[model samples]
Target: MSDASTNAGAGNGAAQTPVQPKMNILAQFIRDMSFENVLAQKGAKGETKPDIQVQVNLDARKRQTEGQYEVVMKLHITNKSKDSGDTLFLLELDYAGIFQVENIPDEQLHPFLLIECPRMLFPFARRIVADVTRDGGFPPLNLETIDFIALYRAELQRRQQAQAAAPATGQA
Candidate 1:
């Protein structure tokens, strides 16, 4: 076989494959969680369609250990009655993960920490929401799949807008 075809010679002109990035979930935990059954507290509920809203936020910071980062996913869920406009339940959760990442470019690392790390931690966070709602005397809340790439883009846009407004507000 030719050296170029077999990639067996030092002088071969074949482009080398890029090194694959690596990430490891060293630990995951729930930093904080709260569930309030407002419907029960008010003692007023009878077969109303629930209007549910979920808000997710992500934060990441570097750890002392080399190539290690801590990412936190914060979830705020509110369920209100469609008929009465009263709150049914409120759930707030902060889930965090420690990840060891390697071989990723600095430009991409921020998005990877906010998007990919939370993507890995999502199932566990979803399950916790389901369990918490069910245990709190309501039907289980099965969260829909999240699009992390979109979330990351939205966050970038939000920050850019905020920065634009900051100078205008400062001048006011």
Candidate 2:
């Protein structure tokens, strides 16, 4: 057989072969959730008190992928007294979902999963945090809408800037 034909056959051989695999949401579960409304009761008592501050940080991680991916949404929330600057409470919640992705092109896969999927999950995760806080006894913590796409772009720019500013390594 000619070399060109032999190479073409080898390449086509893998294309015709079918691999057995399944794409399914094996489980969509909350890995962890922590809630603390330290001043909820204090505030609910209807007494005039010091001002309180609420801060939130959202994070995510992807676990080992066999056919599907387990994506986690981690929330770091804190409450503090604005006047005295004392920490009232701190809570970290990690919620996760098992997403099945198959037959998705590589170019579109990242934006779909990273941007779209996370956006879909954010509200649910936000609700859990807000409800937990309100039930804990303080004022309901209504988290502001986050723009993940903008945040991602800014983060990428920052990294590029940092890399560009760093001195190149070479022997003197």
Candidate 3:
């Protein structure tokens, strides 16, 4: 093949390729946070096992600026004694980030926001949780890595089940 034809074919192939996803973090902050040391108030009498529970929720909204969106991660943590069923501590935190994104298809934006965006913010949120718990007069709480994809799928399944059940009960 001639050099001209070869260049033209390469150009066409490159043009058909999809653009890469782009994202920039404009800012990240803790929007709201609260920690309560229930054990301190109640007083620990003896050794007890800690039952810890963690819940994570994500939300995203568009900003006024073009291509700018805000993503928030809401984390709730609770600690209780397994032996006595006494509450040990409660932590609630809302961490948010301003993200400027490009090249993501409209159909994929929601999942990307809920999954990838929060995945980016998880380390910082985890650090905050550890700090707060330690400051509350307990051992530092090291959080486990979360699987955002699994969480999103479970949420979708939960919603589907609720919707499916709603119609069945409504007719009765």
Rank by lDDT (best first): 1, 3, 2
- Candidate 2 colliding pairs: 40-137, 40-138
Lowest summed lDDT across 10 adjacent residues in model 1 is found at 8-17
Model 3 regions lying over 4 Å from their true place: 1-11
Model 1 reaches what TM-score against the true structure?
A: 0.89
Report the candidate with higher lDDT, 1 versus 2.
1
**What's the true lDDT of residue 170 in model 3?**
100
Best by TM-score: 3
Error (Å) of candidate 3 at residue 22 is 0.3
- lDDT for 149 in candidate 2 is 82
68: Cα error in model 3, Å: 1.5
- Backbone clash total for model 3 is 0
Q: Can you write out model 3's per-residue Cα lDDT over 93-117, one digit (the tens) per residue? A: 9999999999999999999999999
Clashing pairs in 1: none
Per-residue lDDT tens digits of candidate 2, residues 104-133?
666755555555556767787778777877
Alpha-carbon runs more than 4 Å astray in model 2: 1-26, 37-67, 165-172
